[model samples]
Target: MSSRTTDGRSAATTAALLAGPIVMTAGMAATPWESENEITAYQAALAASPDQTQIAAVLLFFGYALMGLAFLSVLRRAGGAPRALRIPAATLAFCGATMLPGLVVVDFYDLALIQSLPAEQAAAVGERAGDYGLQPVMQVPAVAGLLLGGILVMLCAWRSGLVGGWAPALVAAGLVASFAVFSGVTMVAGASCSVVAYGGIALRLRSARIPSSPPAARPATA
Candidate 1:
């Protein structure tokens, strides 16, 4: 593609990536319920307005999807890294991004069940799902993917100078804080960091000139 076309694509990808955090922030704002693993609380929140819960879940799913695409865009832009580093970074980020949708889907299903089923029945089903290890099984990997992948991507971005040093560092720190605390404040902080990093990159892409030559392809070694 021409440099102009490449620049345009980068700009578009950045926008998509930026949308993830924005949507996530909005979803959280709309649903003020704590994200703790409190079935009773969650059910009560969903019971208050099933439609709103569903809408929030949908928004979260799209946000995650867009974030994944943004990670891919960053990976593409990270041509400065060695092939070895880039490959693993891309792989981890890709796996994490792909897993996000599954996590959102499972969460949405649980929310839907809470919305549709009677309180006692929903609680029973939700408890059973947890007892069966379904919740942790799905959640652990998804969270790991998102966290680990994001960390690696941020590191790559830092090393590649795709974004400012402080942005990725702040994002990484926010991620760590969110994981450690699991509170609304920490979550919002992390999401805000993501918004800044990705939004900054997007703005850069819009103004910067695209490189003339594509990144060199790594050669196969026997």
Candidate 2:
């Protein structure tokens, strides 16, 4: 295996990594579900439990943001992760940071629109939303960053020997499978794996210490 290196530089970041996935999993588990119709799914979920839906959205917002922030610590210099690996991974994580958290506002918007507007009217508004040029502009990067960026980071971390292969596999499987699984049960399971993967890394970081800088050379003796 490649050389391993770690520096527990920030306890806060390590905590974030551990907590982020747990919160996200809670959000996923808390999320409501019903008919699979894309157009009406959010509306139905909101109807089933408005408070739960809102709470889940809030949790997701904070969770994804913390995950992004925690990822930054992975990119810290002299950490043994290769420059080539770290650079792209960090860039993707940054891209995710730029918009992933903001995307959660759409959940609130969906709730508001479904509650205040007539069903057909709200549906019409949603359909028209797709017609706008800005729709894809805002959504594409956000989803890609969260999904692709997260997966790549794990890949790089594993390849660079910052983590074991299981770390990447667990996270990647959870992430990819989460997209395929429609039920909340599977969602919770997927997020559970994420928690295990990231939280395990955090545990390691919690115990790690940075290498001390080189000491100053003594002056020549007379």
Candidate 3:
């Protein structure tokens, strides 16, 4: 039983070892999607080509699903900080749910684009916003999910006792402030925080092979 438990721990450590790089690559994938032309092209292609929507949706779903798994793993290995994991896991689940609504809305957007040549042009312009007919409704959940996710991420970083602790916390706090300001700063700050939190954890884990430091050698007793 002891050996089996040790082996399980070893495997989890190894898997966590690889998680950082995998998420780093996902960060790279996300950057391209951020570009205006890329988003516009992504939506336009989905509008013009039936296969594109399927491919894009599959890829996006896979990426997010993988991220969810990674976060869950982090939570599991939190070494007594279960609260840290629960908040993040719940937030991520909510984000995943929010994205599902877009699945239906994007199809509608594409159909609308195909209805007319000039209308397709309008759709391409609107693609930058990625606003389907349902976006107004979708935005509420999306924003809420994102803000909550940021808060959870900040909590994780705080619990981890990593460097630049204030950054994540500040970013999360700034997002909440922006919500009241109505300046769209929430979106910008929240996304920035996600990237920082993602990349920061990857870098930290890479540098610190052992998730927790070794116990200090005890002083000689009298």
What's each prediction's TM-score?
A: 0.78, 0.81, 0.47
Model 2 misplaced regions, further than 4 Å: 1-13, 207-222
> What is the overall TM-score of model 3 with all chains considered together?
0.47
| Candidate 3 accuracy as lDDT | 0.51
Model 3, 82-175: lDDT tens digits are 5646665466546753553344445545545554546557556566465567666756655455455545644665566543576457656666
Top model by TM-score, which number?
2
Candidates' C-alpha lDDT: 0.73, 0.73, 0.51
Give the residue spans of candidate 3 off by over 4 A: 1-57, 77-112, 115-139, 166-196, 203-222
Give the candidates in order of TM-score, highest first: 2, 1, 3
Candidate 2 lDDT over 1-222, as tens digits, reads: 222433334566677676667787788877786557476775767766889989989998888887776576555522566777667777777777678888888878878888989888887887777799878887887778766777777776666556788987887787767678767776788778877877666665554554356578899999
Task: After the best TM-score superposition of candidate 1, give how far the Cα of residue 181 lies from its true spot, in angstroms.
Answer: 3.4
After superposition of all CA atoms, the RMSD between model 1 and the true structure is 8.1
Worst 10 residues of 2 by lDDT: 1-10
